[model samples]
Target: MSDANKKAIRTAIQTGIGVAAALPMIVAASGVPAALPWVAGALAVAGGVARVMALPVVQALLPSWLRTDSSASRR
Candidate 1:
């Protein structure tokens, strides 16, 4: 696969893992019903996909000082 595609998949997986790990704590802190956590997990996955797809645009919009160098180049 192309580098860009690989990067996107990596980002999506990382984001999903982060969201899944945080969901329980978030739900517990808010004292919301248990069923709502499933909805939150779904939203997190959607948001992760959207963010991965938009990453290039986001990087372009950020100022140079705020942007990190591509770590993939170091691999």
Candidate 2:
């Protein structure tokens, strides 16, 4: 797969994992499931690992898309 695709997929996975880890914690503390904390911790760690593995591969293959201008063109 291309670098751009890999980067985007990694980003999406990271976002999903973060949300999964947060939602349960935001629920009623008294209603919290016994396994909620473990699930969240697992997701966070998985996402972190995926990021560590995918980011360098993507960055190395992708090119910079940003632009810089010291001054704007006179119009």
Candidate 3:
């Protein structure tokens, strides 16, 4: 697939992950009960994503805009 397509997929995945991580916190902070389970699930998902992101192959998939090096060639 093209770089732009890959970048869009990556962005959408990360946005979903961000929303998943935030939902539990928002619920808990709002004084909702039974949020512990949701928090635990979100934590697990975040941890798994973090580990996957640390992989060299996964890092290679990251968009240039999201890279720490910030040295992408300009056209």
Candidate 4:
């Protein structure tokens, strides 16, 4: 696989793990009826953003300044 594909997969897995970890807290907060819409909207937007960030095209287009390369930082 190409580097872009690997990066995309890594991004997706990281996002999935994050969403999984946050699921219980999100579920607990859903008990508030008035806050349900906002919670759902936030989840939808977050999911959309995660999905977008995982795309190869987006990965390639991302500015280098935003990247956090640990090896580079250590130098």
> Who wins the TM-score comparison?
3
TM-score of 2: 0.36
Better of 2 and 4 by lDDT: 4
Where model 2 places Cα greater than 4 Å from the true spot, the runs are: 29-75
- lDDT per residue (tens digit) for residues 1-75 in model 3: 999999999899879867755765766687766447876677677667666666666556667666443333131
lDDT tens digits, residue span 1-75, model 1: 999999999899777767665766776787887667676666566667556544765555555654444532233
Off by over 4 Å in 1: 35-75
RMSD of each: 10.6, 9.6, 5.9, 11.1
Worst 10 residues of 4 by lDDT: 66-75
Query: What does the lDDT read for residue 60 in candidate 3?
Result: 61
TM-score per candidate: 0.44, 0.36, 0.47, 0.41
Over the stretch 1-75, how does candidate 4's per-residue lDDT look in tens digits?
A: 999999999999878757855754776776654357776676666667667766655655655564344333333
Model 4 global lDDT (CA atoms, 0 to 1): 0.65
Q: Which candidate is the best by lDDT?
A: 3
The TM-score between candidate 1 and the true structure equals 0.44
Looking at candidate 1, what is the lDDT of residue 1? 100
Off by over 4 Å in 3: 1-11, 20-35, 69-75
Structural RMSD, model 2? 9.6
Tell how far residue 36 is off in model 1, in angstroms: 5.4
Judge candidate 4 at residue 74 and give its lDDT.
33
